[model samples]
Target: MTASRARLAGSTALVTGGSDGVGLEIVRMLADAGADVIMPVRNRAKGEAAIERIRETVRDARIVLHDLDLARLDSVDALTAGLREEAAIDICVLNAGVVLLGDRRRHLTADGFELHFQTNFLGHAALIRGILPLLERSRARVVVQTSIAAARARIDWNDLNGARRYSPYRAYAASKLALSLFGLELARRSGRITVNLSHPGVVPGTAIAAPVRALLPQDLVNWAVHRVGNAPATAAQTAFDAATSEADAPVMFAPSGPFGLWGAPVPRAPFRRFLDADAAARVWREVDRLLS
Candidate 1:
């Protein structure tokens, strides 16, 4: 169903990591569709700059900027509280993420948790739970942006926090896997709410590679990605399609293009082990205990 039947127009939508890149593109599309776009970004100044770019494309776009550091639980708490009081959000896109450079041996958050897990997985999960009541009131939909890296690493429940060993790439992959699990679990538990996951292909041109380029020439990575990967706009299209498309099941898995590698956003491959109810429940139970 389109926005009219879904009642998306004039309703509020929230996009985490909406400062730039694919997330910003998603914000623009949602704004054009008549949803008030709420951008929760890590750097307040950069986010405001991004809002300027959106204004160029979307006139009269309702965009709200709020500071949110996914690496810190406290920041998520503040964002959820403020948004809950202000908006009856109709959709939420969990799109913010980070890829640590190889030079960094170990990454840690302000609260001393593993950076990737806390920021990309745990922090977002907590925020989702915090905002569940708002979603319930509005009957909203949520789309979690996962990655192809999720297939490379399975979430080892015992090492979720990465206290045992620290590898940035593995840590990132594990976090995405955990998010995929949470998406499936959330759909099952809520039963009434719409929950889905999408992978935005290997968008080599995205801001994700900018930090690595600061260390080494980014052109090499950019070249390889452009040859076979996706554009940020392509990735954004997948996210937008996955979020707006109605499906029979609550949990929808989509990839950018074909064979789960890259293309437009369409239902691609099933997330490995995601259909395991036992594992999903285990993850949910463990996460619940930690958050509690």
Candidate 2:
């Protein structure tokens, strides 16, 4: 039963940030299920190495890489050009992101926008917009990797690009928060494709844990965190579920453990408060204005 559910057989998927950690795990699982995986990577050599690793174990893992620097909208454009030239995509996973420690200094993206907001959310949003025709062509499912941090943020139209002020962590968290809000709203606006937001519990060994560990004094604090945290491979299972499962769910899946902190893809609806149709509309309007 599980094998059948895992089977992609001939479907095509694009996994951004498929080079390492949680993203690598996801690519492996998808390839094992017979997906022709498209990896849009910042570094081509690193992506080749990751594909080799997957092929070593999964054999015949259909994986291809397209040079994509999500930080650059132009790169995003090039990636779509290459992908459209290939075949229709069945799944587009917006998984690549970075959390630069701007302890006291502010950084910017190639487009001159706040680094985190531009890369983490806006870049992917542009990717989605650019690929809309392809998505419609393939009837694709879009998966946005949102984080638990989103629960701590609300859409801020006034300073979305952090024109007024910026804190590295706030910028990172806000970017992720904005993605979730957009994912929910995007789904509400366009029902032609299924758009889902997911939180892959506390996978402590992953880069997401790096920010938290940076502030800790002891190395043990970091080691202990990964030891007790969710496994990277397991953390991606929910993403796999969202991309493949035919479950009829109204809300996105927040796959964590019993406490919503660690584990597999357990069924979940996002907070009911987030379900307010009006709020979802407002999110769409504000983000559209900010990015426009």
Candidate 3:
């Protein structure tokens, strides 16, 4: 086994959204690297298929699936409770997310929050809170998947739920920005756990690119994706590197290609907003209050 993979022989990783896209790729990489992987899925059939696919490449891959729906806090709580029984969790990748470009109308979760805000940011926030003890005990490497969209978005303090004015892209970007801020704050607050951020450079087949695919001609979209965007597996490398890195200082791993869209994963400076300590603290407080 490679040196990196060998280092993870006895490690355990919990990955959210591991049933598909870049999340699935991260799970496969962890399993191949000799880490036991636990994936929380919203669908049993899909989760089983993902495990089957992983076992195809690693005959003795150790993987477990738990039911989770990031849109619902109760589901997040159940998964966290089950995971608390584990001995240790060495790595946690908060990667599950949703983009609602397909539907322009505003949607709310059962918790009565904006769909994107709750699923992408708030739910993950709640999960982190629930598992903070495990993470601290294990000194786990926690990697949060963020997006380039976060750089361009700003939180609407007055309308966090987008109840006043709504747009698909705005809601999605805001959620990512909030998530990014939370990651930064977590890094500052937890000296025991190593917290890092990752941006899976644009990958066309992923949900984030669904709108682009629908609007462009098939051939053109394919060409653009090949020329400028990464494939899911390629994009996943950023998060994988962040999760396994020995760096004590927090860093944001992102693509090194042109316009930061495609290429090898490398450490990059976080966007200015991501470094706003005041903003990060505010986000943490707001999420805590909302979850409580």
Q: Which candidate is the best by TM-score?
A: 3
Q: Which ten residues in a row have the lowest lDDT in candidate 3?
A: 1-10
Q: What lDDT would candidate 3 get against the real structure? A: 0.91
* TM-score, prediction 2: 0.90
Which wins on TM-score, candidate 2 or candidate 3? Answer: 3
Residue pairs with backbone atoms closer than 3 Å in model 3 (clashes): none
TM-score of each: 0.89, 0.90, 0.97
lDDT of 3 by residue, 1-292 (tens): 3455766899999999999989989998898888999999999999999989878877778999999999999999998898889999999999999998989999999999999999999999999899899999999999989999999898999999898899989999999999989988898999998989998899989888988899999999979878878888998899999999999988999999877888999999988888889999999999878988
Error of 2 at 36 (Å): 0.4
lDDT for every model?
A: 0.78, 0.77, 0.91
User: Model 2, range 1-292, lDDT digits (tens) per residue?
Assistant: 1366457888999898899988998899889888889998999999999999888878878898889887888898887776667668888888888877535577777788787887888888878877777887787788888777666666556777777777777788888877766676777666567776667877777776776776777777757666566787887887887787675343456555665777667768775545667766776676567557
User: Against the hidden true structure, what lDDT does model 1 obtain?
Assistant: 0.78
Please identify model 2 stretches exceeding 4 Å from their true place.
Answer: 1-6, 215-219, 222-227, 286-292
Give per-residue CA lDDT, model 1, range 1-292, as digits (tens): 2345334577888999898888988888888778888899888899988888988867767898998999888999998888779658778899998777454566778877788888888888998999998887776788889887777676766777677876778888888878878878888888567877768877766655556556656677656676666777777877787677788475444554555666666776556666778877887887798688
Model 3 error, position 4 (Å): 6.2
Quick one: best lDDT, which candidate?
A: 3
For residue 150, what is the lDDT in candidate 3? 90
